[model samples]
Target chain A: MILAVCLNPALDVTYAVTALRPGTSVRVRSVQRRAGGKGVNVASVLHQQGVAAIVTGPAGGSAGTDLTAGLDSAGIGHRFTPIAGATRQTVAVVDADDATVLLEPGPVLTNAEWTAFTTSFADLAHEADVVTMSGSLPGGVPGDAYGRLIGLAHAAGTRVILDCDGSALIEALHDAPDVVKINEHEAASTTGIETDSAEGVFAAAEELHALGAKEIVITRGAHGVAARTGQGRFASTPAGTVDGNPTGAGDAFTAGLAAAMAAGLDWPARLRRASAWAAAAVAIPTAGAIDPGVATDHETRTIVQELPA
Target chain B: MILAVCLNPALDVTYAVTALRPGTSVRVRSVQRRAGGKGVNVASVLHQQGVAAIVTGPAGGSAGTDLTAGLDSAGIGHRFTPIAGATRQTVAVVDADDATVLLEPGPVLTNAEWTAFTTSFADLAHEADVVTMSGSLPGGVPGDAYGRLIGLAHAAGTRVILDCDGSALIEALHDAPDVVKINEHEAASTTGIETDSAEGVFAAAEELHALGAKEIVITRGAHGVAARTGQGRFASTPAGTVDGNPTGAGDAFTAGLAAAMAAGLDWPARLRRASAWAAAAVAIPTAGAIDPGVATDHETRTIVQELPA
Candidate 1:
C-alpha cells in the first residue's frame, strides 16, 4: 500500500469571473472547491489509478472536517489527526486572461500536535510499502519534520519519496530517501542554477543524488521529467505539450513513480510511466484527475535520451 | 426577537496580502473567515448590541457547515435548512491600497429545499416581532421569493423590514412591509435617482414610502442616514468621516433601526440612534462591531434638518 502525507492541507477554492478589476466588485461566474495539498493530491491520483493509498496529516476545525468528508466521498482512505486550529485554504481567481492564486500560510502546529502526528505516522509507515512525504510543513512545525519522518519510515523498512523544497527538502536529503522529486523552480533554487537546459537540470540532479537521495526526479512543465538513479541517468519528454491545468502534474508523476517502483519496474521504465501520468494530468482541467486511459493509451512518442553521468 | 433572513448565506473569506498582482501567486499575510450575508451581518450587529435575534436561511455542504460552525463560535443563534449543494463563498483580497470583493452567486436551491426553508421561515416569523429579509436570492430561487416571504411574515403578524435591490425589492414593495432600508446605491437603482445628496436620498425615501412601505430608511455611507415616516421626514449626518472597514455599516444601521423600532422610539430618535450605530461601525476594524461608548458619546454634531415633504 502507498501512504501519502500532507502536513498542510487546504480547501482549494476556484472562483471564475469574466474579468478581474481593481476598485470594483466582480460577480463570480462559478466556484469549485476541493480538498488539496501535494500529498492529498498524490493520493487522489493513486485512487483514480486503482491503486490503494491512504492520506494522513494534521486536520482540524470545520475545514478539516470538510477535507476528511471530501476524502471519504472520493473513496480515498484517510486518517487525519484533529488539531485545534483550522486548516488553510488556497484560492484561485480565474479569468480568460489569467489565474491568480492566493495561498494561505497554514495553521501553526503545536509541539504536542506534531508529536502525536509523528507517533501515528510511524505506525502507518510500518504497514506501507512506499511512503511519500509531500508539501511544506505548517508554521511551528520543525523544518526537519520530513527528515524525522524519513528516519521512522526507514526503520519500518518502507521506501520513502520526498517532494518539497527549501529547508524541508534540504533536511530530508540528509536521510537519503529512496526518491526525491521536484519541479524546475525547486531544482533551480536548490542548486542556484538556471535549469533551462538538460545539462543544468542534470547538474542539479547530480547535486541531489550526491546529497543522499538514492534516486532523483526533476520535472519540467511541458518538457516532461529527467531522472538519475544507481542504474543510470535518463530524460524523457512527451511528444508535445498536453495543455490544460498543470497544477498537479508533479504529484501525478510521484504517484506513478511510486506505482512503478512497487511494481518492480526498471529505472528507465519508471521514468516512462511517470511521464505518462504527468502527460495525463496536463490533459485534464483539474490537478488530481486524468483523461480516461491516458497512461494506457499513452502512444505519444516520448523521446528518452540516456545522458552521461 | 428579530428574525434576520439571509437567503444567500456565504463564508466571507478575507485574505490580506502586502499587494495583489494578477497571474501570480500571492502569499496571504492573514486569513479571516466569518458567516456573512446581509441578514447575517444584521444579526451579528444585533448580537453585538445585546439585542435578541435569530438568523436563518438555506445552508448546505462544506461552506454551509463552516458558516454555521463559525456562527456557533461567534455565539449567534441560527437554524439553516440543509440542502444538497454547498453554500457559496465571497472572497475579499485586501491590501493596504485597495480591497477587491468577489461576490459568488450562491447555490441553486432545488424546489424542495426552497419549500422546506419557506415552511421553516413561516414558523419562525410567527414568533418574531420583526422579520428582516435581506440579501439576494440564490439561483433556482425565484426573484419574488422575498415578496413571498413578506406575504408569509405578514400573515404571521410579523412586521417586515425589507432590505434588498432590483426585482426582489420591487416585489417586496408590493407586499407593503412595515419598513424598507437600503443603501444610497440600492435606493438610486430602485427609483432611478442619483441619491448622492441628502435631498436625493430623501426624494428616494419618499418614492419608497409612496410605493407602499410604511417607513423608508436610506443609508449614505459615512454621510449617515435619511428617513421618512408617517410622523415626519428627517435626516442625520455624522460630523465627519468615520473611516475604517465600512462593509457592515449598513447592517449595523439596520440592527439599530430594528432595536429602536422594537423599543417604540420616536422617528427622529430612531434615525439618530441608527446613524450613531453606523458611525460607530466605521470606527472599528470589522463591519458588525462598534466602538464602545461611540453611540453614547456620539456628540458628533449631527445636524438633523427636518425635511419638508
Candidate 2:
C-alpha cells in the first residue's frame, strides 16, 4: 500500500457562471466541490487504478470536516491529524470564455501539531512500501518538512516520491528522495534555467541530481517528460493528442509512477506507464480521473528513447 | 424584543488581493468571514445598538455550522431550524480598484422544512413586539412565503417590517405589513417604474400602496429615503456625505425602522432614525456594523420635509 501525504488540503469549490463581470454580482449556474490537494489527487487516481492507497495530512475546521466527509463518500481512505486552524479553500470561477482562480493561504500549524503529525506519518510510512509527499507546506510548518519525511520513509525501508515546488523542493533535494516529479515551469523556477528546450530540461534535471535527487522527471505539457537517473537519461514522448482538463494530470502521472515502482518496473516501463496515465487524465473533464481504455491505448504507443551518456 | 427572520443565511467570505486578473490564479492577501443574510444583518445592528433581538432561520451542513458559530462568537442570540441541504456561501473578491461577487443559490427547502420553520417563526413572532423578515427566499419555498409570514404576524398582533424584492415583494404587499423597505433599483424593477426622480419614487410607492401596502419606504443611496404612509408622504435627506461600504446599508435601515417602531415612534421620527442608521453603516468597513457617534450626528441634522399628497 502507498501512503500519500498532503501538507495543505483544500476544499476546492468550482463555480460555473454564464458570464463573470468584474465589480458586479454574478449568479453561479452550478457549483462543484471536492477534496483536493496533490497528494489527495494522487491517492484518488491510485484507488481508481485498483491500487491500495491511504491519504494522511493535517485537516481542520469546517473545510477540513467537509474534506474528510468528501473523501469518505468517495470511498478513499484517510487518517488526517486535526489542528486548530481551518483548512484553506480554492475557488474557481469558470465561464465559457475562461476560468479564474482565487486561492487562500492555508491555515497555520503549531510546532506541537507538526511534530504530532510527523510521528503519525512515520507510523503510516512504516506500514507502506512507498510514500508520496505532495503540495505546498502550510504556514508555520518547518521549511525542511519534506526532508524530514523523506528521512523517516528511508529509515522505514520504504521509497518516497516527492512532488513540490520552490523552496520546499530546494530544501528536500538534500535528502535524496527516490524520485522527484515536477512540471517544466517548476523545473525552470527551481533551477533558474529556461526549460523550454531539451538541453535546458536536461541541465535542470542534472542540477537537481547533483543536489542529491536519485531520479528527476521534468514534464513539459503536451511535449512529454525528460528524466535523469544513475542508470541513464531517458525521455518519453506521448503518441497522440489527448485533450480535456490538465488540472490533475501531474498527480495522475505520479500515481502511475508510484504504482509501477512498487511493482518493480524499470525506468523505461515506468515512464511509459506514467505518461499513459497522464494522457488519459487529460482526456477527462475532472482532475484525478482517467479513462482506463485510453491509458491502455497510449501505453503501447508511447515511445521511450535513451539519451547519450 | 424583536424577532428577525433570515430564511436563507449565508457564510459570506471576502478575499482581498492586490489585483484580480481573470483567467489566472490570484493569491488572496487576506480573508474575512462572517454570518451574513439580510435579516441576520438587521439583528447584528440591533444587537450593537443594545436593542434586544433574536434571529431565526434554517441552517444546515458545514456552512450552517460555521455561520451559527460565527454568530455565537459575535455575542448574538439565535435559534435556527435545522435542514438537510447545506447552506449557501457568497464569495467577494476585492482588489484595489473594484470587487467582484459570486452568489450561490441557497439550499432548496423541502415543503416539510418550510412548514417546520413557519411553525417555529410563529411561536417566536407571538412573543415579540415586532417581527422583521428580510431578503430572498430559498428555492422550493412558496412564492408567497413573505405574504404568509406577514399574515401570521398580524394574527399574533405583532407588527412586521418586510424587506424583499421582485415577485416576493409584489405578492407580499397584499398582506399589508406595517412597513416595506426597498432600495430604489428594487422599487423600479418591482413597479415597472423608473424611480430615479422623487416624483417617480412616490409614483411607485403609490402603486405598491394600491396593491395593499400600508407604508412604503424607498431608499435612494446617499440621497436619503422617500416614504408614503397613512400619517402622510414624507422624505428624509441625510445630513452630509457619508461613504465606506454600502453592502449592508439597507439592512441597517431596516433595523432602525424596526427599533423605532418597537418604541412606538411616529412615522417622521422612524424615517429619520432609519436614514441616520443607514448613513452610519455606510461610514464603516464591514456590513452589520455602524459608528454610533456618526449615527447620532446624522440623526440630529437630518432633514424631514412633507411632500404633496
Candidate 3:
C-alpha cells in the first residue's frame, strides 16, 4: 500500500468562461470543483490503477471538509488530520484556448497541528510499503518538513518518493529519499544546470545525488524522463506527443514510479512506466485522472534508452 | 424587524493578485471570503446600522456551510433553510488597478427545496415589518417567485422591497411590491429605455409604475437615485462623487430603504437615507460592509430634490 502525503491541498475550482477578460465581470458557464494537490493526484492515479493507497495530510474548515468529501466521492481513501485553519483554494478560469489559474496561499498550521499530522503520517507510513510526499508545504510548517517525514518513513521501513522543488527539495535530499521525482525546470533552477541535454540532466542528477538522494528522476515534458539510479543512468521518451491538460502529468509520473518500486521493478522499467503514465495523464483534461487506453498503448510504445555511465 | 431574503446567496471569494494576465498563473497575495448576495449585503448593512434584520434563504453544501459561518462570525442573524444542493460561489480577482468578477450560476433547487424555503419565508415575514428580496433567482425557481413572496409579505402585513433584474423584475411587478429598488442599467434594460438623463429615468420609473410597482427607485451611479413614489416624484444625489467599489451599493440602498420603511419614514426621507447608505457602501472595499463615518458625513450632505410631478 502507498501513503500519499499532500500537506497543501486545495479545493480546485474550475470556472468555464466564454472568454477571460481582465477587469471585467464574466459570467461563468459552469463550475467544477474537487480535491487537488500533487499528492492527492498521485493517490487518485494509484487508486485508478487499482493500487492500495491512502491520502494523509492536514485538512480543515469548509474547504478541508469539501476536499475530503471530494476524495470520498472519487472513492479515494484519505485519513487527513484535522486542523484549525481552512484549506487553500485554487481557481482556474478556463476559456476556449487557455486557462488562467489563481492559487491561494494555503492555511498556516500551528506547531501542534504539525505535530499531530506528523504523528498521523508516522502511523500511516508504518502500514505502507511506499510513501510518496508531493507539493509545497503550507505556511508555518518547518522548511525541512519533507526531510522529517523522510526520516519517519525510513524508520517505518517504507521507501519514500519525494516530489517537490526549491528549498524543500534541497532540504529533503539530506534525508536520502529512495526516489526524488522532479520536473526539468525545477531540476535546472535548483542545481543551476541546464537540463536540455542528457549530460546536463545527468550532471544535475549527480549534484542531487551528492546532496543525498539515492535515485533521481527528472522529467522533461514531451522530451520524457531522465534518471540516475544505483544500477545505471537511463532515459525514457514517449513515442508520440499526446495533447490535453499537462497539469498533473508529473504527479502521474510519481504514482507510476511508486507503483513500480512497490512491485520491485528495475530502474529502467520504472522510468518507462513513469513516462507512460505521464503521457496518459496529459491525454486527460482534469488532474488526478488518466486515460487507461492511452496508458496501455503508451506503455508498449514508450522507448527506454540506456546511457553510458 | 426586516427579513432579508437572499434566494441565491453565494460564498463570495476575493483573491488579491499582483496582476491579472490572461492565460497565465498568478499567485494570490491574499484571500478574503464571506457570505454574499444582494440580500446578504442588505442584511449586513441593516445589522451595521443596529437594525433588527434576519437573513432567510435556502443554503446547502459546504459553500452554504461556509456562507452561514460567515454570517455568524459577522454577528448577523440568520434562519437559512437547509437544502441538498450546494450554494454557488463568486470569485473576484482584484489586481492593483481593477477587479474581474466571475459569477457562477447558483444551485438549482428542487421542488421540495423551493417549498421548504417559501414555508420558512412565510413564517419569517409574519413577524417582520419589512421584507427585502434581492438578487437574481437561482435556476429551477419559478419566474414569479418574488411575486409569490410579495403576496406572502403583503398577506402578513409586511412591506416588500424587491430588487432583481430582467424577467424576474418584470414578472414580480404584477404583485405591486411597496418599493422596487433597481439600478439605472437594470431599469433601462428592463424597460428598453435609456436612463442617462432625468427625463429618461422618470420615464423608466413611470413604465415600472405602470407595470405595477408601487414605488420605483432607480439608482444612477455618481448621479444618485430617482424615484416615483405615491407622494410625488423625487430624486436624491450625493453631494460629491464617492469613488470606490459600487458592487453592493444597490443592496445597501435596499437596506436603507427597508430600514426607513421599518421606521415608518416617508418617501423623501427614505430616499435621503438610502442615498446616504449607498454612498457609504461605495466608500468600502468589500460588499456587505459600510463605513459609519462616511455614512454620517453623506447623510447631512446628500441633497433631495422634489421633482415637479
Candidate 4:
C-alpha cells in the first residue's frame, strides 16, 4: 500500500460566480468544498486508479471535520492528527470566464502539533510499500522535516517520492530518494542552474541526481516533460495541447509515476505514463485524477521520444 | 421584561481590506463576526443598557453556533430555534477608508420552521411586557409575519414596537402597534408622503398613526429624531454630531425608546433618551450597543425641543 503525507492541508472552497465586481455583491451560483493538499490529491488520484493508498495529515476544527468527510466520500483512506488550531481554508472564486482568484495561506501549526504529526507519519511509512511526502511544511514544522521522513522511509525499506520545492526539496536531496518530480522553476531554483534549453534542464537534473536523487523528472507545462534515470534520459510531448484548466496537472503526473513504479514498470514506461496522465488531466478541469478510460486511451497513443544522453 | 424576535438571524462577517479589486485575491487584514438581525441588535443594546431583555431567533450551522456564543459572552439571554437550513451569513467588505459594501439576502428558512418560530413568538410575548419585531423576514416567511406577531403581542397585553419597513411595516400597521419607528425613506414609501421637509416627515408619521399606530418615531441620522405621541410632537437634535459608524444607530434608538417606555418616561424624555442613544451609537464603529458610561453622559445633556402638534 502507498502512503502520502500532506503536512499543510486545506479546506478548499470553490465559489462559482457569473461575474465578480469589486466593492459590489455578486450572487454565487454554486459552491463546493474539498480536502486539498498535494499529498491528499496524489493519494486520491491513486485510489481512483484502483491503487491502495492512504493519506495522512494534520486536521482540526469544523473545516477539518468536513475535509475528513470529503476524503471518505471520495473513497480515499485518511488518518488525521488533531491540532489545536483550526484547519486553514483556501477560497477560490471562479468566474464565468474561467478566471480564478485563489486566497490561500491556511492555519499555522505549532511545534507540538508538528511533532505529533511526525509520529503518525512514521507509523504510516512503516506499513507502506511506497511513501510520498508532498506539499509545504506548515509553520513550526522544520524545513528539513521532509528529509527526515525520507530517512525514515529508507530505513523502513519503503521507496520514497519527494514532491516539494525550494529549501525543503534541497534538504531532502541530501538523503537520496528514488524519484523527485519538480517543475522547471523549482528545478532551476534548487540546482542554481539556468535552464533555457533541454540540455540545460538535463544538466540541472544531473546535478540533482549527483546530490542524491536516483531519478529526476522536470515538468514543463505545455512543452512536455524531461526525465533523467540511470538508464538514460527521455523527453515526451503530448500529441496536441488542449485548452483546459491546469490546476492539478502536476499532482496527476506524480500519481501516475507512483502507480507505474508500484506496478514494477521501468523508468522509461513510468515517464511515458506520467506525461500521458498529466496531459489528460490538463484536458479536464478537476485535479489529480482523470477517468481511467481516458487515461488509458491517452497513454496508449502518447509519443515518448528518446533523447540523446 | 422585553423580548426581541429576529426570525431571520445572521452571522455578520466584516472583512477589513486595503482595497477591493475585481478578479484578484485579497488579504483580509481583520475579520469580525457578530450576532446580527434587527431584533437581535435591539436586544443586545437593551442588555447593555441594564435592561432585562431576551433575544429569541432561528440559528443553525457553525455560524449560528458562533453567534450564540457571542450573545452569551455579552451576557444577553437568548433561545435559538434550530432549523434544517444553516443560518445565513452576510459579508461586508470594509476598505481602509471605512467605505462598506454590504452583501444582502441571508439564508432562507423553511415553511415548517417559520411555523415553529411563530409558535415561539406567541409564548415569548405572553411573558413579556413589550415585544419588538425587527428586521426583514427571510424567504419562506410571509411578509405579514410581523403583523401576525404584533397581533399576538397586542392580545397578550404586550406593547408591540414594530421597527421594520416596506410591506412588513405596512402589514404590521394593520395590527396597530404601540410604536413604529421608521426612517424617512420607509415613511415616504409606506405613506406616499415625500419627506423633503420635517413637516413632510411628520405628515407621514401622522398618516401611519391614523392607520392604527399609537405613536410614530422617525429617525433622521445626524439630524436627530422626531416623534409624534398622543400627548404632542417632540423633536430632539444632538448638540454636535460626531463622525463614526452609523450601522446600528436605528436599533440603538429603538432600544433606548423601549427602555424609556418600560420605565414610564414621558414622551419628551423618551424622545431625548432615544436620540442621545442613536447619536452615541453612530459615534461608535460597531452597531447597536453604546458604552454604558457614554450612554449615561449623553442622557444627562441631551436636549429636547417640543414641536407644535
Candidate 5:
C-alpha cells in the first residue's frame, strides 16, 4: 500500500465571478469546493490511475469534517488524526483574466497532537511499502517533521518520496528520503543556486544529493524534468507545450513517480511515465483530475534521454 | 421579549491584507469571523444592551454550526431550524481604503425546510410580544416569506417590525406590519419614487402607508431620519456624525425601535432612542457592538421635531 501524508489539508473553494471589483460587492457566479493539499492531490491522482493509496494526516474542526467527507466521496482511504483546531480553506476567485488565490493559515497543531500523529505515522509507515510525505506543516509543528517521518519510514523498511520546499525541504534532506521531488524554482530556492539552465539544474540536483537526497527530480516547465542519482542522470522532454491548467501537474508527477517506484520501473521509464502523467494532468481543467487514457497516449510519445553524469 | 428572524444567516469572514492583486496569491495578514445577518445583528445589539431577545431562523451545515457557536458565545438566545443545505458565507477582503465583499449564494431552502421554519416561527412568535423579520431570503424561499411570518405574528397578537427591501418588502407591505424600516435608497426603490429630499422621503413614507404599512421609518444617513405614522409625522436629527464602522447601524436602530415599542414609548421617543442607538453603533468598530454608555449620552440630547402630517 502507498501512504500519502498531508500535514496541512484544506477545503479548496473556487469562486467564479464576472469581475472582481476592489471596493464593491461581487455576487459569486458559481462556487466549487474540493478537498485539497499537495499530498491529498497526489493521492487523488493515484486513485484516478487505479493505484492504491491512503491519505493520512492530522485533520480537525468543521472544515476537517468536509475534507474527510470529500476524501470518502472520492474513494480515497484516509486515517487522519483528529485535533482540536479547525482546518484551513483556500479560496480562488476566478474571473475573466484573473485567478486570485486567498490562502488561509492552517490550524496550529499542538505538541500533543503532533505526538499523536507521530504514533499514527509510525504504524502506517510500517504497513506501507512506499510512503510519500508532502504539503506544508501546520503552524506549531516542528520544521523537521517530515525528516522525522522519513526516519520512521526508513526504520520500517519503507521507501519515502518527499515533495516540499525551502526550509522544510532543507531540514528533511538531512534524513534523506529515497527520492526528492521539486520544481526548478524550489530547487533554486532550496539549494541557493540559480537553476535557469540545464547545467544549473544538474548542479542543484547534485547539491541535493550531497545533502543526503538519494535521488533528485527537478521539474522545469516546458523543458520537462531532469533526474540525477548515484547510478546516472536522465532528463525528459515532452513533444511541445500542452496548453491547459497547470494547477496539479506537480502532484500528478509525484503520484506518477511514487507509482512507478512501486511498479519496479527503471529510472528512465519512471521519468518517462512521470512526464507523460504530468502532461496529461495539464491537459485537463480541474485540479488532480486525470484521464488515464490520455496519460497512456502521452506515455508512449514522451522522450527520455540518458545524460552524461 | 423580542423575536428576531434572520432568513439568511452567514458566517462573515474578514481577511485583512495589504493589497489585493488580481491573478496572484494574497496571504491573509489576519482573519476575523462572526455570526452575521440583519436580524442576528439586531439580536446581538439587544443582547449587548441587556435586553431579552431570541434569534430564530433556518441554519444548517458547517457554517451554520460556526454561527450557532458564535451566537452562544455572545450570550444571544437562539433556536435555529435545521436544514440540509450548508449556510452561506460572506468574505470581505480588507485592503487599504477598500473592503471588497464577496457574497456566496446561500444554499437553496427546500420546500420542506421552509415549512419547518414556519412551524418554528409560529411557536417563537406566539411567545414573543414583538417580532422583527429582516435580511435576504435564501434561494428557493418565497419572496413573501416575511409577509407570511407577519400574518403569523399578527395572529398571535404580536407587533411586527420588518426590515427588508426590494420585492420582498413590496410583497410584505401587504401584511401592514407596525413598522417598516429601510434606508432612504431602499425606501425610494421600494416606493418607486425619488427620495433625494425631505419632501420626497415623506411622500415615499405616505405611499408605503397607503400600501398598508402602519408606520414608516426612513433612515437618511447623516441627514438623520424621518418618520410618518397615523399619530403624526416626526423627524430626528442627531447632534453630529459619529465616525466609526457604519455596517450595523441599521440593525442597532431596529433593536432600539423594538425595545422602545415594548417600553410603550411614543413615536418621537422611539425614533429618538433608535437614532441615538444607531449613532452609538457607529461609534464602535464592529457591527452590532453598540456601547450602551454612548447610546444613553445621545438619547436625551437628540433633537426631535414635529413635522407636518
Candidate 6:
C-alpha cells in the first residue's frame, strides 16, 4: 500500500461566484468543502483509481473531524495525529472569469506535535510500498522536516516521492528522494531559470536530478508535463484543453505516477498515465480527483510524444 | 432561562488589513472567529453578563461544530439540531479606515430541516423565560418560519424578541412579538419612513407598536437609541463617541434588554442597561459581548439622557 503524508492539511473551501468585486458583497453561486493538502489530494486521486492508500497527517479541531469523515466516506484510509490548534482552512474564491484568489497559509503546529507526527509517519512507512511527503510544513515544524522524513522512508526500504516547494524542497533534495514533482514556477525558483519553455524546464529538471533527485517531473499547466529518469526523458501532452478546474492537477499527476510505478509500468507508460490523470483532473470541477469514468476515458485517449534523449 | 434561536447562524470571520486592494492578495494582521448570527451573539452577551441562556438552532458541518465549541467553551448553554447542510460563514474584510465589506446571506436550509428546527424551538420555549429569534432565515426556509416560531413561543407563555430584516421581520411583526430590536435602516424599511431624524424614527416605532409589538427599540449608531414602550417613548444619547468595532452592538443591546426584562427591571433602567451594553460592545475590538471588567465600568459611566415623554 502507498502511504501519503500531508504535514499541513487544510479544510479547502471553494466558492464559485459570478464576479469577485473588491469591497463589495457578492453572492456565492456554489460552495464546496473538501479535504485538502498535496498528500491528501494524492491519496484521494489514487483511491479514485481503485488503489488503496493510507493518508496520514496532523489534523485538529472541528475541521480535522470533517477531514477524517470525508476521507472515510471516500473510502480512503487515514490516520490523523490530533494537534492542539485547529486545522487550517484555505478559501478559494473562483470568479466567473476563472480567476481564483486563494486565502492560504493556514493554522500553526507546535514542535511536540511535529515529533508525534514523525513518529506516526515512521510506523506507517514500514507497511508502505512507496511514501509520498507533500505540502509545506506548518509553523513551529523544522524547515528540514521533509528531509528527515525522506531519510526515514529510505531507511524503511520504501521509495519516496517528494512534492513540495521553497526551502523545504531544497532541503529534501539533499536527502535524495526517488522522485520529485514540481510545477513550472517552483522549478524555475529552485533552478534559477526564468523561461517556462520546454528546453528551459528540461534543463532545470536535469539540475534537480543532479542535486540528488533520482527522477524529476516538471508539470507545465496546459502544456502537459516533462519527466526525466535514468532510463531517458519523455514528454506527454493531453489531447485538448479539457477545461473545468486545475486546482489539484499536480496531485493527480503524482498519484498517476505512483500508481503506474506500483503496477511495474515502464517510465514511458507511467508518463502517459500521469498525463492522462492530470488532464482529467483539470477537466473535472472537483478540486482533488477526477471520477473513475472520466479518468478511464482520458487515460485511453491520452497521447504521449517522447522527446529525443 | 432565556433561549435564543439563530436559524442562519454563521462562523463570523474578521480579517483586519491595512488596506483592501481588489484582485490582489493581502496579508491580514489579525483574525478573529466568533459565535455569530444575531441570536448567537445575544446568547453570548447574556452569558457574559451572568444570565442563564440556552442557544438553540440548526448547526452542521465543521463550521457549525466550531460555533458549538465556542459556545460550550464560553459556558453558554446550547443545543444544536443537526442539519444536512453546513452553516453559512460571513467574512468581514475590515480596512484601516474602519470600512467593512460584509459577505452575508449564508447557507440554505431545507423545509424538513426548518420544521425540525421549529420543533426544537418549541421544546426550548417551554422552559425559556424569553425566546429570541434572530438573523436572516436561510434560503429554502419560508419567510413565515420566524412568525411560526414567535407564535409557538407565545403559546408557551414566553416573551418573544424578534430581530431580523426584510420579509422575515415583516412576517414576524404580524404575529406581534413582545419586543422588536432593529437598526435605523431596518426600522425605516419595515415602517416605510426614510428619515434618520429622531422624530421620524419615533413615528416608525409608533407604527410598529400599533402592529402589536409591545416595545420597539431602534438603535442609531453613535446617536444612541430610540425606544418606545406602552408607558411612553424615550431616547438616550451616549456621552461620547465610543470608537471601536460595532459588529455586535445590537446583539449586546438585545442581551441587556432581555436580561433586564427577565429580572423584572423597569423600562427606563432596562433601556439604560441596554444602551450601556451596546456602547461597551462597540468599544471592544471583537464583536458580540464585551468583557465584564470593561462592561461594568462602561455601564456605570454611561450618561443616558431621556427624551421628552
* All candidates: interface RMSD: 1.3, 0.8, 0.8, 3.9, 0.9, 3.4
Supply the global lDDT for candidate 6: 0.81
Ten residues in a row with the worst lDDT in model 6 chain A? A96-105
Error of 4 at B115 (Å): 2.7
Ranking by DockQ: 3, 2, 5, 1, 6, 4
**Which ranges in model 2 have alpha carbons more than 4 Å from their true place?**
A192-206, A220-224, A227-233, A305-309, B192-203, B220-224, B230-233, B303-309
Candidate 4: lDDT of B141?
78
| Cα lDDT tens digits for candidate 1, A1-309 | 999999998988889999888557899988777899999989999999898999999998777888898899999999898899889878899999998899887888899999999999999999998999998889878878898999999999999988998788988888888999999899999878789998898889988888888989998877777888888888886756676877788888889888888788887778877888888887888878876567765524667778776
Each model's TM-score for chain A is 0.94, 0.97, 0.97, 0.93, 0.97, 0.90
Count of clashes, each model: 0, 0, 0, 0, 0, 0
For every model in order, the fraction of real contacts preserved is 0.85, 0.83, 0.95, 0.28, 0.74, 0.31
TM-scores for all predictions: 0.89, 0.93, 0.93, 0.90, 0.96, 0.87
Per-residue lDDT of model 6, residues A111-163, tens digit only:
88888998988888999988888888888787888889988888888898888
Poorest 10 consecutive residues of model 1 chain A by lDDT?
Answer: A292-301
Chain B structural similarity (TM-score) per candidate: 0.92, 0.96, 0.96, 0.93, 0.97, 0.89
- The top-ranked prediction according to TM-score is 5
CAPRI category for model 2: medium
What lDDT does candidate 2 reach at residue A41? Answer: 94
CA lDDT, candidate 1, residue A225:
79
Look at candidate 6 and give me any clashing residue pairs.
Answer: none
Give the alpha carbon lDDT tens digit for every residue of B79-189 in model 4: 888876667766666676544343434567788887888788788888897787788877777877888888888777889778888887888788888999988888898
Candidate numbers sorted by lDDT from highest down: 2, 3, 5, 1, 6, 4
lDDT of 5 by residue, A33-130 (tens): 88999889888999988899999998987789989989998899889999998888889999999999998878999999999999999999988868
Docking class of 1: medium
Q: Write the per-residue lDDT of candidate 6 for residues B18-85, one digit (tens) a residue.
A: 77665565666666777788888899888878899998889887779888988888888998888878
Error of 2 at A147 (Å): 0.9
lDDT of 4 by residue, A117-163 (tens): 87888888888878877878776777788888888788888898889
Please report the candidate that would top lDDT against the real structure.
Answer: 2
